[model samples]
Target chain A: MIDRLAVIGVGLIGGSLARALRAAGQVGEIIGCGRSQENLELALELGVIDRYAQDPAIAVRDADIVFLAVPMGAMRELLASIGPHLATNALVTDGGSVKNSIVADARVAFGCMPPWFVPGHPIAGTERSGVGASFPELFRQRRVILTPLPETDPKATARVRAMWQATGAEVSEMTVAHHDEVLAATSHLPHMLAFGLVDALTRMDCSDEIFRYAAGGFRDFTRIASSNPVMWRDICIANRDSLSAMLARFSTEMSDLAASIRDADGEHLLEVFARAKAARDGFVDGGKSLAEHN
Target chain B: MIDRLAVIGVGLIGGSLARALRAAGQVGEIIGCGRSQENLELALELGVIDRYAQDPAIAVRDADIVFLAVPMGAMRELLASIGPHLATNALVTDGGSVKNSIVADARVAFGCMPPWFVPGHPIAGTERSGVGASFPELFRQRRVILTPLPETDPKATARVRAMWQATGAEVSEMTVAHHDEVLAATSHLPHMLAFGLVDALTRMDCSDEIFRYAAGGFRDFTRIASSNPVMWRDICIANRDSLSAMLARFSTEMSDLAASIRDADGEHLLEVFARAKAARDGFVDGGKSLAEHN
Candidate 1:
């Protein structure tokens, strides 16, 4: 059990984690920290955190585990603030979507990558945000990916994994580069497509009729387009290289698809669509899609 | 009241309409026709249809209304098969996703776009298809677009509109060209993106881990990828011009978004994301998303 846990940026991610730990009876005292005093008070009143701190440094002081759940753009400053004040035995982790940037920030903040700093990301979210939008069940049956640096302590990683496991999450580890690239394919690029598609329609088609007539499938398909924009922006910039590369590759494929349509190549369209359907059918039918929980 | 109704292709779309009409007591002598005799039998057994016919011609011989719900690829042949046999006073409409191709097919088969043929599309569907998946509530609170020709009988259009209204759908009308363009922007393009994205990832990534670790949001966003591949390929081929144009425009926008990411233009990214979110938020909150029904 965590004796004292510090969760900086106590919004959806951190607030949900705090609630999960509280529900599991796995934590002693949870301290919520964020730039928003009102949000922190809300978190405290909701019992998501036992107390609150406005500063990351004070929040992490003497804490057994410090979880930085702030947006990616704020991670560098957060790392710098908490590095000097964290207990020597304290384990530091994060819920940032991108790993390489967090690793880079840790390296710069500590002058060397500390063995206690374990970078991680929980692969779960909704089109909702804020402390009020969080719940203990958010991480249940979800995947939590950890990208531990080479110099990180194995015990730190293990403890982090155990903490996530207590919340009913499946945890695994991968290299920072691989995590970012894979996430680019699965998470980041999808967000970009959703955002870009809606934006394009809004700009090109002056009529709101375009969206009005969009079917239920389109609504479900573009649900992610309603996600928090600032957090996604920070993520886009943090994982720029992989996301940009994926977007370039996707754009080329789409162009090719357009050419096929132009050439009236129903055969090629059927081939690609059939293969895609097979992949998703297998995944969703496997009973491990994690789609049911959400 | 209708004395008889012939529903060619007794799958999700036609079967759902049959069930809805029966629930409302608005249809009589529902005749199911399809190439799949087993499926047609199932529709009859489930009460989605009152009788089964293997041939469209035989099915519509005395029917007062004919609702063609076959794939776009099959619509042309089905039109030809039923044209000579349709009742002289029949009101014929279709649930084809594309209007222009269906209209063109009717012109070729009947030697003219018949006054009784009202081209219509009900903007409702799920990834699941087949007669077993049909339900009376499929079209509840959904939008159905009708594109009636200038020569089409106004009484036929009004009756078709009333039939859909009986299913608790909000019915609207537009020209054939506008209907195809709007659907291309809203439905067709999103399907292409989902299918293409999944297909691209499967080809590039060798490990099944990409699909295994995909989050709930990713699964929901790509749910449409699991839709009937043959049907989508047919839609793509039928609405080639509009879909191709939309895809080209979307690919360009995606390329531009990628450039912003490569250049680290977080502001531009945030603006696009925020606007897109607003559009969806308004639409979903407006209680017209129809996502709740599905």
Candidate 2:
């Protein structure tokens, strides 16, 4: 068990992690650090954190473990601020969605690959945010991917993995580049598409009528459009290369679909649509088994 | 009350309408007609219809009202066969998603504007199809848009409106072109995007991994992709012009978004995403009120 754990930028991810560790009785003291005093107060009152600190440096001074759960935009500055204060042997991990950039930023901040630094991302969250949205079971049965630097100490990685396991998360390891690429395709690109679709509809002359007549299908398809704009913006910029490639690929597919419609190519349209349906059906079945196994 | 109701293409839409009419005691007899004898028999056994017929011509022979609930591709042929059999005073209507084409097809099939022809579309359905998936309350509290031709008799329009009202659907009237345009932007475009996204992923070398790691957001966004491909393919072709226009517009927006990501234009991305979130929130709020009123 960790004697003291420090969580910077105490929002949904950090707050949830803190709460989970407390419930598991795996951490003796949890320190929450954030720019918003009100959020830290709420986290403390909710018992998600044992204490609150406005300074990241002070928060990690005596901590055995540190979790940087801030947005991608804030990761570099926050890492720099806490780098000097973290105990030499403290295990460092993060819950950022993008990993390559974060790992690079950590390297620059620490002046090298920090043996104690273990980059991780828990693939779990809802559209909600802030301390009020945190729950002890948020990471239960979720996938937490750890992408450690080559110079990282194996013991530090093991400690981070054990912490996630204590929170009921299944931990898996992958390269930082692969984590970024896979997430860009599965998560970032989807959010961008949703945001772009809704933004496009809003610009139309018949925008009101379009939204009024939109059925349940449209609503579900664009649900992620309601996600946090700032957070998503940071993700898009951080994973620009992979996401741009994905966007271009999707645009090509859409263009082909449009052409099929224009030519009334029923056979081609049917083939593409049938393939999509079968793929989605397979995904749903696989997801069910994953859930059952978890 | 109608003396007789002939429902052509007895699948989800037609079977649901017949069941609703019977539940409301609004029809004397319900005749189900379809190419699939097994589906028609299922409708007969479920009491969605009182009898079944293999020939559309014979089905509408003595019926006072005929509802063509077939796909867009089958509409022309079915209208041709039943045109000569429909009673002179029969109120002929349809449940096609795209109204402009159906109305145009009706004119060609009938040799002129038929005063009894009304084009209607119920903005409701699940992913499942066939008569077995039909239910009496399928259209209850749903919007049923009716686009009547200029030559349509006011009495015939009123009769069709009242029939839908008896099934607990809210009926609204609009120009055929307007209905097609609005639905193309709201429903057709979203479905095509989902299909295209799924199809694109299947083409990737990491297709299996992509699907395996897809989260709940991806599942919800692509749920409509699992719908019947033939039905969607017909929709894409039937509403080609409007859908193509929408596709071009959406592609432009996506390109702008991609540019923002490539340039790391966080402000532009945030502005677009924030606008989308606010719009989606408004739609959700409006939908809740609509549900409450219903």
- Candidate 2 stretches with Cα past 4 Å from truth are none
Instruction: Estimate TM-scores for all models.
Output: 0.97, 0.95
**How does candidate 2 score on lDDT?**
0.89
Q: Please give the distance, in angstroms, between residue B189's alpha carbon in candidate 1 and its true position after superposition.
A: 0.3
Colliding residue pairs in candidate 2: none
- Report lDDT (Cα) of residue A223, candidate 1: 94
On residues A91-190, what C-alpha lDDT tens digit does candidate 2 reach at each position? 7899999998998798789889888999999988877789999998998877889998789899999999999999998888999888888898888888
Model 2 over residues B1-294: C-alpha lDDT tens digits? 999999998888898999898899999999989999999888888888989889999999889999988889999888888887778778799899998788778878988878888889999887778999999898887889998877989899999999999999889999988999999888899899888999999889989988877777888989989988988988888899999999999999999998999999999999999999999989888888888898
lDDT at position A130, candidate 1 = 92
Q: What is the interface RMSD of each candidate, in Å?
A: 0.9, 0.8
